[model samples]
Target: MVGGVKEEYQAAQELLTCMGANVVYCGPVGSGQAAKICNNMLLAIGMIGTAETMNLGLRLGLDPKLLAQILNMSSGRCWSSEVYNPVPGVMEGVPSANNYQGGFGTTLMAKDLGLAQSTATDTKTPVPLGALAHQIYRVMCARGYANKDFSSVFQFLREEEGQ
Candidate 1:
């Protein structure tokens, strides 16, 4: 998403569109960063939730793909579940399928969550879940998942279980 003065954003959007970017003008200056921070914070939380749910399903003897499909068709549906499933073997072309090799790295996600946490603190906004997600990602980064895709939280969770 683009932000800042509308005219300036329009000019930038024209150039971005030339490169086939699907950009949206969010609002004033800093709005784009705000949007990204909010989005990544929620994405981190959703991915964690998805990983937890998928782990539970696996331990319950439910097939990962089938459980993912059920979630996609139900109220539990989210991008993490339907698109970037956290469970290995559930979806192809995602980091999870490739052993969490390529995609948004855990360190990057932890950084984004740090931004979100800082923003929330500065605004005096309550973000209990976001804070928890931030801590989780921070721990993930410290546990040797810094370069792995954030979806590797699934593996992180699994390892934690083993301990």
Candidate 2:
């Protein structure tokens, strides 16, 4: 997937053959397409998880922005935090808090997650989390916010009423 289309598909087919697996012709185009779907799905889930975790920190009164600062300065922060910035206002220039716009699209993510689920079922692998993630994204896409970024997952946070 990291390589160009031709290489990725060839690699997939080669791996399958090496493992004595059989399937229809999966060329570079196919591999690239599959990866596009899979990566976006996972990306959406990561965005959602990161947003929720940061919200949890806020509920602890850690000051999301401050906590985010600490994470960026510390090892606790990851790509979603350090690079993606899911808390919206925490990073001063991210999409999280601002209605989760200007980020990855929910529909794209749902499409990929759907592929992932299909793969899991075909392989008979345990991917309940992936399945659930796909379901959430499917619902998210069905909602009117289909135009927002994946970080729009923070919408879930705004909905939680904490008296």
Models 1 onward score TM values of 0.96, 0.71
Segments in model 2 whose C-alpha atoms lie over 4 Å from true places: 2-29, 73-75, 160-163
The TM-score, computed over Cα atoms with residue i paired to residue i, of candidate 1 is: 0.96
Best-performing candidate as measured by TM-score: 1
Tens digits of per-residue lDDT for model 1 on 3-112? 89999887777688886667888999999899999999999999999999999999999999999999999999999999899888998899988989989999999999
Error of 2 at 9 (Å): 9.9
lDDT of the candidates, in the order given = 0.92, 0.69
lDDT score, candidate 1: 0.92
What local lDDT score does residue 155 receive in model 1, on the 0 to 100 scale?
97
Which residue pairs in candidate 1 collide? none
Query: Which pairs in model 2 have colliding backbones?
Result: 37-112, 88-97
The digit string of per-residue lDDT tens for model 2 on 30-134 reads: 564666656665676667677777878877888877787887787666677787776667665567656677767777777778888887788798877778788
